[model samples]
Target: MPAHLSYDVVIVGGGHNGLVAAAYLARAGRSVLVLERLGNTGGAAVSARPFEGVDARLSRYSYLVSLLPRKIVRELGLRFAVRKRTVSSYTPLGDGGLLVGEGRTRASLAVLTGGEREYAAWRDFYGMTRRAAERIFPILTEPLLTRDELRAHLDDATAWRTLFEEPIGVAVEERFRHDLVRGVVLTDALIGTFADAHDPSLVQNRCFLYHVIGGGTGDWDVPVGGMGALTDALADTARSAGAEIVTGHEATRVDTDGATAEVAFRTPGGPAVDPTDGTVTARHVLVNASPQALADLLGEERPPAAEGAQLKVNMLLRRLPRLRDASVDPREAFAGTFHVAEGYEQLATAYQEAAAGRLPTAPPSEIYCHSLTDPSILGPDLAGSGHHTLTLFGLHTPARLFAEDNDAVRARLLAATLDQLDQRLAEPIADCLALDAHGRPCVEARTPLDLERDLRLPGGHIFHRDLAFPYATEETGRWGVETAHANVLLCGAGAVRGGGVSGVPGHNAAMAVLGR
Candidate 1:
């Protein structure tokens, strides 16, 4: 097929991680080919003009780039731009009032508790655990490991303690002044995990902090134009480095002999014909999509099943929803990201519901207004800018979205969000202009079975296999890239250290390939 074009490496997904790997490999003088499903290359990190003259990043879909290493930015000279913004949270009260919290603020700890004693308790809890992240951040950017290689980084006692002992949540709670702060700090624990926030193996907090500290807490960065530009820069870098990135090519199957693997996919412009059985032989294959997608590609070649799933929803709002503090300007409020957990108890309950496959009544949601962070998104005048988008993550949706009667669930999620906004903003619903659901229209809806059919991940487990359990411990933390497969590497979100914008999968996989 196509004259048997061969390369040293063939990357699937064209997502940020795949792009990162392709760029690095190409720079090292290896020939590479990057395949993407969407017309655009960026996987989740994409931008589109939803309305005329008003551009909003699908920012809410997968916002922020904290886990992305600053060193990689400099080394690649990847023209991606990021504005350092703080992280803030507001819980709207029914009384047209708001409660605010910050990463390192005493005021934030106060918001989490009802009194001084709890605040002191929370402060201590947060301080001790903050060290957990500090200790692990520098280590994630390195290569994956073998058991012996992993042990080289850990002293015997630390290794033993991490494996057989230590509870992640309780360990974190011991450092914070308020339960809410502990929940937020521990929130990272559930990003791709199925465990309860307060579950045992407290060292998981260290894993959470590892990702947080990699980007530095409170330093949320915004792409200059939209998230799409970041992906664009990556694509440009890959192209400049001599990698061929072909979009609109949907991979159907990965045929493998005992030694080499070949990807089969379809190019666009046909009358819905089955995928062409083309093949690319490579010394190494890097999958940048979710683990669930990869599992499907392998068919019976599944990794041990990992529980839990990632559900994302995007909404186009008539206007920004009002929150607890009406006095806080929307611009200042939008400077950082926001979440919808009133306190620790509420957050814990939400996480539990997600694990149970029930949509939490008061689902924990992330609200990001990219237009506020990057002026380019808004028109010449920002106010009354009817065009805006809000991405809700950590949202608990039913296991099935396409099933009949799912509208009831959607309505409930919408109503709860609207009620919260009305109470928080002191604003009326009449002011809202347009509405769209990303799940129904953008992601799960448009790309039905995409996570399963293409990426081969389980239940669209977007964060990769569960790493917080076995991967987070001291003994295994150093095993960032080594998987059980030979010549087969772990180069997705679930790779050691797990998830976020860090590009560690691709970076670490590259090191493994280069034997660096």
Candidate 2:
């Protein structure tokens, strides 16, 4: 083997976590190198142009931004490029029913529900939880370990009593008279959690707590241009700070010998015999892929067995959807996301079928129209006119797609969605445009088996290190960050403190590396 290219740190995968880690490590004056398998950066946070010439921001797998710390963006000087968006979501019921809320509008529930008693009930539940968020946000951003430190912060007798010992359903039902209204508020309970929304688990309420805790209340925003721009900004920041990035370099194995580690990856243009052409050795290694990705590199010795998993489906629409309501002005077509599931029973049914490894026939889906917000997404010229694009995310498909026929599932999902929208909007499909050269429409399915088989998460569970109820503790969500191998750290969605584009896990892990 040729000589190893030594560095102070080697970050595998250039996703936000890896990029954040690289930036911090480089900022600390440690030599850092980031290896990415794809030509573009940002794993799930990436944006792609599904249609040529005409650009559409494909948040691809992960859509929307919540739980991201404003402090981290500031500290890292990430604000210059990050385009923040406030949320204006409307959950539409099949009839003319709708649940609308904007930017921490829990205070304005009366307006949202039109003076309904249900609005007051939700205000109480959200009010109490939002208050808890104010207290919890600061703690989550910082790293914690000491019992006294954890206790002095989270040991709030009052906060604990309200958060843990309460019937959340009753509390929520009291807030809104409309079951649909209460359902919309509660649906956020499982953004990345594997729990049911109505589950009596205090973790359900905590999901809401964590989202608003970061003080990023309101509609979801993108980082200008597209989701890829967020990664571009991070990449630019890393490179400007003197960090090195090598794309199309896939790390096959991470060889560790107690004290030091070496990463072996194949160089795209290099010879089959020269795998070492791209190999690098480092004092520290950070694994940013799913836990299963780490297990693939580290083997069963770490992560050891299956966890849960999640299925992601992405759709590229030819034209703007035909809504049922023609009276709704086109200008009123906001880029806000719309969640379809309305009540506890609806969510429960979806969850039970999903847990059983079968896709829900009528799945609860969340739809977002990015073109509605930034007409520039269509290009500089189309800024004044409304552009065309749509996104629909369905839940509870088995993580393992190897067994099922993906083509059939995709058609079924698309057909169901069109039918649902048509029934609601009362529109014809002849007006919609399906573009050519966009290549064949395809569906990407990842099953628990895929998460387990490829990502190596336990039982295909994506949160390899869960931080939810029963698993919520100082150590529970910590991932392997503060675990056995002090030099090794886990910094993905599975790690403690939970997932999303928050980048907390990576930021916290970087701090751990610095021993700060």
Candidate 3:
């Protein structure tokens, strides 16, 4: 083994969470080193111009931000900014569509459901969620709360039943009458989660709770200058706090004694034959990789089976596609999330089909045009040239579907998804696509398999694994990031209350190390 380079703490994986932990720990005067396998640090939260010679920079994998706590940003003094969307979402239905935003909700709800009843119900439903958010969001950064303790903290039995005891589908069905409205509400429960809305397991409820309780506001804003800006700010914060960040160095193994952990890693351009090119010893090790990845590093068995359930597609458009409903402008419809064929029945059908090992006839997906909100993503020449960037999130497309014949399945799925988008547009979306320098349309699609290969996400599960309810289960009063090894802690999305761009897990891991 090479001579050990030591530190007070070593963080595996320099993703946003790892960077957050590094910043907090280093700020407290702990010598910290962060090792990232990728050449860059952002992991899934990154921006890139995939199309050769294109001026448009797209947020490739993880698109929006909602779960990030304001406390982390404020404490870390991160300089990143997230801009709110004036329009929340627009879902096309037949010749008309529902546009929910500032000053548009009432009329859109009336049009979709033919009355003001659904709007009133929508407000009521969100009011309940808001209350739940108030109780839950505050507890995320603290030590884990037992279910009984959490229920007591929640206080209201009705809110507990709605969010914890029952499936989220029940709440949606009981509140909304319109299929489109129900689907819009249900989409929150299904993002990155592969489960039926009505699954008896209440997994959808867990998913829905996290989605709506982000920053206790439930507003998913776009990070200014793409997602990379957020990570850049995190990296800068850590570096400013004296954290050593080493990119292109992948941690290969973690060996720990009762008091210290030693990490073995390989640098870029090193010989592939040898697993360990260097070694680092630390008083504490924070793993920002997935649980399964960490288990592999420890030469232990893998964790429970988890698979990602979304297809991500990115495209640069020459011009925005005209909406079938001419009443609303294309820019308005595209500025916020554009839901395509994601009605309640549509999502259910797609889920059923995908669960049965077949692709949905009409894929359930949503899109948003980043340029409409932040034109800075495009170069000066393309800023005013009618060019825009579109990001799509397709639902119910699990990793298993692409396990065999990935390319063919991805092609068919993409075609179906685009066709579904066409149904709501005045012109074919493909016709509006911009050409890359290679004379090909500027479009890219990523399946679960693709994400696994590129992002090192085991099974491409975005949240690392299915999100657990944010309370403690086995370890009472302990930080959720605690692991079996005394000197090792989980600081990634796999940790409890750990998904999304939220730095709660990272912060808690640092707290554990600091014994605070």
Candidate 4:
């Protein structure tokens, strides 16, 4: 006989979002079951020891934490904590670079551009975004607002126009005169999103809005114990609230009318998944997987493919690489975002090249050293021996570029990317790499295709799909997480206003169930 179970709600995919929904619903006296295809939960938000015999635990896929709400943290009593980054970012020019954060941003700006005009514009622009963040972030958990209602919430007409009305590139161009400053501002609109700065679709605008409004202050912080710590806390909260979590259960199908649902699954090496034996019935079903996966489960025709656009490289450096700029310390520079080859013209040229199906001559990328903020992720030996972890995320290298030969393309792309970074550093990054126990260099690169196969992110898109506005659309209900079937809800990154590490989708889905 195949294993069978029943619950008030069955969640397919035990990612952090699913765990959040499970915790909230279970706390409200609802019976919940979370099925995860992987042996462990947390999904992309996980930490792993990639290098052999390395004591360092790196936040593998999703690194920073900014979008998680304090309401969920308090309601669930999660023991998660995050540390503020001292430096905001560092973009290298020739001998001097533009440094942001730690009270020296103005000085750095003045030094680089030889004036305070850029700094003044920077303050005005960011102040606008900060105000917009305060107004827009609080409503993410409540019932979705219509576009007009959202505009009313954000009463500033100029702020609204800058973020929503015209292309984000227009605002960037009109606000800042320096090409470096303009490129730095435009980078936010392109992280994990493949789009031209002035794409008519306004996709870049949507992406820019999400990045700035995170946490109501637009500050992305380092998680205290890596990204896994947050999910671990959520899983604990859900379990304590009487939720059942089953790992290695791949959800195969969901048959549901408007009122009730039955979920079919198959475990690794298990018999064929059919409703007869390997099935569980539930009054409600919440899919915490990608939108494409959700369509497959509901047995609907798959939607258009959403392709991811980025390159991820993780390295265990024996020590931080020295920078070409001798004035700034490596620790301060690497603590925040270390941008390379991302000048405004460079970014535009790269996009044009990539759009034409060729790798950019100079790929734009950012690097972050997580251990500088929280050294606890390192073991005693590694922490004391000056070892640190570096995470590099490359832009403009979309998933389509790796379709023919992922390995060969990845190698060619990695070399070109490192070559770009090498220009900003005094020495090549390769010399600073620590060797694993197997004597291999402690560096690994993951293309979007690697992410697709590993994490089931449809087309390896990090947001699961292109993000939608937080407001209610015609296809959705009062809650952005709603689906066509009343009994089914989407609780994944694919939901509207549901990208990043935020549990907004999960929280909104739970509130929709609770009729809040």
Clashing pairs in 4: none
Error of 4 at 439 (Å): 0.9
Cα deviation at 218, candidate 3, in Å, is 0.3
lDDT for each residue of candidate 1 in 251-281, tens digit (9 for 90 to 100): 6666565356777777766687754556677
Give per-residue lDDT, candidate 1, residue 100: 40
Per-candidate clashes, comma-separated: 38, 39, 0, 0
lDDT tens digits by residue: candidate 2, 89-178: 655555344534454445434544667566556555556656666656665656553444543555565545544565455555544576
Candidate 2's TM-score: 0.83
Query: Against the correct fold, how does model 1 do in TM-score?
Result: 0.80
* lDDT-best of 3 and 4: 4
* Best of the candidates, lDDT: 4
**Of candidates 4 and 3, the better by TM-score:** 4
When 1 and 4 are scored with TM-score, the better candidate is 4
Whole-model Cα lDDT of every candidate shown, in order: 0.58, 0.60, 0.90, 0.92
Minimum summed lDDT over a 10-residue window in model 4 is located at 268-277
Task: State every prediction's TM-score relative to the real structure.
Answer: 0.80, 0.83, 0.97, 0.98
Cα TM-score of candidate 4: 0.98
Stretches off by above 4 angstroms in model 3 are 1-4, 270-276, 475-477
Candidate 1 positional error at 504, Å: 0.8
